[model samples]
Target: MTALSELNDDIVRSMSVGAVFSDFGGKVNSLDFHRTADLLVTSSDDDSVRFYDTTSAKLVKTTYHKKHGADRICFTHHPSSVVCSSKHNLDNSGEFLRYLSMYDNRCLRYFKGHKERVVSLSMSPVNDSFMSGSLDHSVRIWDLRVNACQGILHLRGRPTVAYDQQGLVFAVAMEGGAIKLFDSRSYDKGPFDTFLVGGDTAEVCDIKFSNDGRSMLLTTTNNNVYLLDAYNGEKKGGFSMDSSQNATIEATFTPDGQYVCSGSGDGNIHVWNINNEPTKVACLDSYIGVPTCLKWAPRRVMFAAASSVLTFWIPNDAKPGLESGGLNSEV
Candidate 1:
């Protein structure tokens, strides 16, 4: 295993641009990058919302979530709206965020309706509409045009959601190995299709739509990942990680859709080539613990992974560490 010092030096030197804001002594649960201002918005167990400059790596602002700790945070595609959720107890004994809180100049407006804690939140890739998934087993769509709940579709179980590129279709992965699709135009009535995953019976942990919205990726608690056809809900291919001792937490497609990167419970990030035959491209072995989250930057040719600490990875243009070739050569 490489030492932390060596990993830090390699990342710092190879990183064309990055940031390290470690003021929060707690784990960062979620992170989102604002495209317009090039600001990074991060939420952690420390109950703080931090904004950092993506260019100069400077701390811009810090705001508390009104004494309530945040679990997940996301920015609407619009530059004006921000949404955040409170941490939820595993035993369901404590108060969680029942509504999505929109922030503007430190003033917050709650979009209340769900009876349970909000587990996942995402913004439409093509519009100002946003979607939220709750433990109440429902997905709700919110439109900023009216600041009200435009539609709600109940699922068989709690789900994680992602929107397609056109903002017309949304995918929700339920707890019982099922993924449902709903059209924003017809979301008020019902889902268009409910697709069942094969192989592992573990609950779906995360889901993401490909860059072109032609495919979707699903990660489960059983170290298995599946790529599905976005149109008809047919399985294109699937892969399982032998090194993943624990569940796969999240999987995401690179900007070009040639690779899929995932964070596992074994304190490592795995990259897979999805262009031809799917294979393990690289394994990022720098993280110290289970990576709670991962985010790919929009413009930069880099990505960030978060556990107890936030780590950035840029292409090793000189000498690549893994057998997958240098990041620059591949990306």
Candidate 2:
């Protein structure tokens, strides 16, 4: 067999289940892992945010937001702090964005501004500041210490936002395949660089930057995932999904930036070797339902994907070498 095919075979052989969380009663809408901990936070249609200890696969804490159901959940810089966007209160007295202390499920702050449902949320790598994108055609920046938006970018269509690893720059993807990059220090000055993705592809559902801050991934509703040079906006490659499925497939880059993993409506997880020629490396099947959220651990040989269940994939007998940096955590 060719060398590429052999590499694919080896990867498929090494990857296996490291942990499984099957307690989610409804579909998992979003998931985020702590940067340096063995913990995972998940928001589900069950109107709760659950935390799992990756090593033990135990649900450590569950925070239920009943009236304004939880949707996009993410852990801020603090291990005990979480930010999520949910529906308004049944009494029409609250906001869609909330910051909570996960330890006791105490609501610490509420960011109110978006008139429509918030579609996306991302935490900055360096601070308590975070960004939220909404179907209201705006992307707002909020600080955990405040209850109001620090800044807002009004767009023509749905907006998806991401911050670089250093929190030095941020990218915003909006309608008509437009990507605008702004400096975190002075975002109000407008984009310093802009890139336009051309093709039949349209709406961008999610945007993420590689851990190294050198590359970007844009997953669109058109069943296409585009990999771009994060700095210059040059297109590096693109991965195609089965358009027949018509689901919002979330794709993520491994911490090493060598591969990309995504979920399919076919109830399977797909991995691609992007460091070489960007080919389909493997497909893991037999999932109970469509896995909508996929995230790679920041410093481990493992990654996690969620459907109604949370599954962690790790390379068997994998050792951290000179390249992988080191083990992420004790987990």
What's the TM-score of each model vs. the native? Answer: 0.80, 0.90
Which whole-number lDDT from 0 to 100 does residue 166 have in model 1? 74
What is the lDDT of every predicted structure here? 0.66, 0.80
Q: Write the per-residue lDDT of candidate 1 for residues 76-176, one digit (tens) a residue.
A: 76544567776644234333432333344453445666777787888887776888888888787876555467888777777788888678888888866
C-alpha RMSD between model 1 and the true structure: 7.3
Cα error of candidate 1 at position 212, Å: 1.0
- lDDT per residue for candidate 2 within 1-331, as digits (tens), equals 1122233446654776655677777888899999988788999989989887655555688878887888898998788889989864723754889898998788898888888888889898888889999988999999999887899999989999999989999999998999999999899999999998878348898998987898999998866889999988888888777653535778998777778887776777788888856878788872556677889777665677887777766665543321242333222
Q: Which ten residues in a row have the lowest lDDT in candidate 1?
A: 322-331
Residue 311, model 1, lDDT? 58
Residue clash pairs of candidate 2:
none
